[model samples]
Target: MEAYRLLIADVYELAGLSRRTSEEMARAVGQTAARWHVLSVLSDAPRTVPSAARRLGLAPQSVQRVIGDLVDSGHVEAVDNPDHARSPLMRLTGQGRRALDELFARSEDDRAAVVDRAGVTAGELAAAREVLRKLAGALRTSVPHP
Candidate 1:
């Protein structure tokens, strides 16, 4: 239990540090971390605003705002959704792809440095990811008490 508690703390700190680093990187590319994240999520495939928000663990309204901004900046576009008329799917534009590609190029070094600094084996990383996923699933399914 103590080890688990420590792991949670470490994860929290890591997330904060990562967010800051991402913010810096995004700023270098003339974007914010929130925009970068929304772009990354859209890069995989077009999704409705709500769906993208769920994937990003962000509020739907917040995601909607980012999507609106992206559209205004010509980074993303809203396409017709066959399944839902009211909710359109947001897809990446060429400019968005270029920006995302540039961001990836910029972060390559930081990603490598994390591996070098941690000195953790690939297997260890995989195991850690699996454990975190399992815990996340459990937490997501937990019953809420009023």
Candidate 2:
């Protein structure tokens, strides 16, 4: 019980630290956290705003705003959706791919810094990732959805 309580506090701390570092990296790539997240989710495939929002666990309107900004910046493009006529699927453009690559490269140093600071072995980090995944799955079940 004490271990679980400590784990929860540690996870919250880690989440805050990660978000701050990620925001800095995103800013360097000319994106906000929301924009970066949207681009990342679309990296695999084009998705409607609603789909992207759901995956990101964000409001659709918020995601839509970020999507619009991405489009305006030519980082992403909207294509005709076969399934939905009104909502087009958003895909990354060549520039978007380049930006993502650049972002990753820029953030690599930050990631390394974190690992060095934590002094954690690769195996330990892997284990941490598995634990976090399990925690997320458990929490997802208790969260309400619209």
Instruction: Pick the lDDT winner.
Output: 1
- What TM-score, computed on C-alpha atoms, does each candidate reach? 0.87, 0.80
Q: Pick the candidate with the highest TM-score.
A: 1
Candidate 1: lDDT of 6? 97
- List, residue by residue over 37-78, the lDDT tens digit for candidate 2: 788899999999998998887899999999999999999999
Summarize candidate 1's per-residue lDDT along 57-96 as a digit string, tens digits: 7789999999999999999999999999999999999999
lDDT of each: 0.92, 0.88
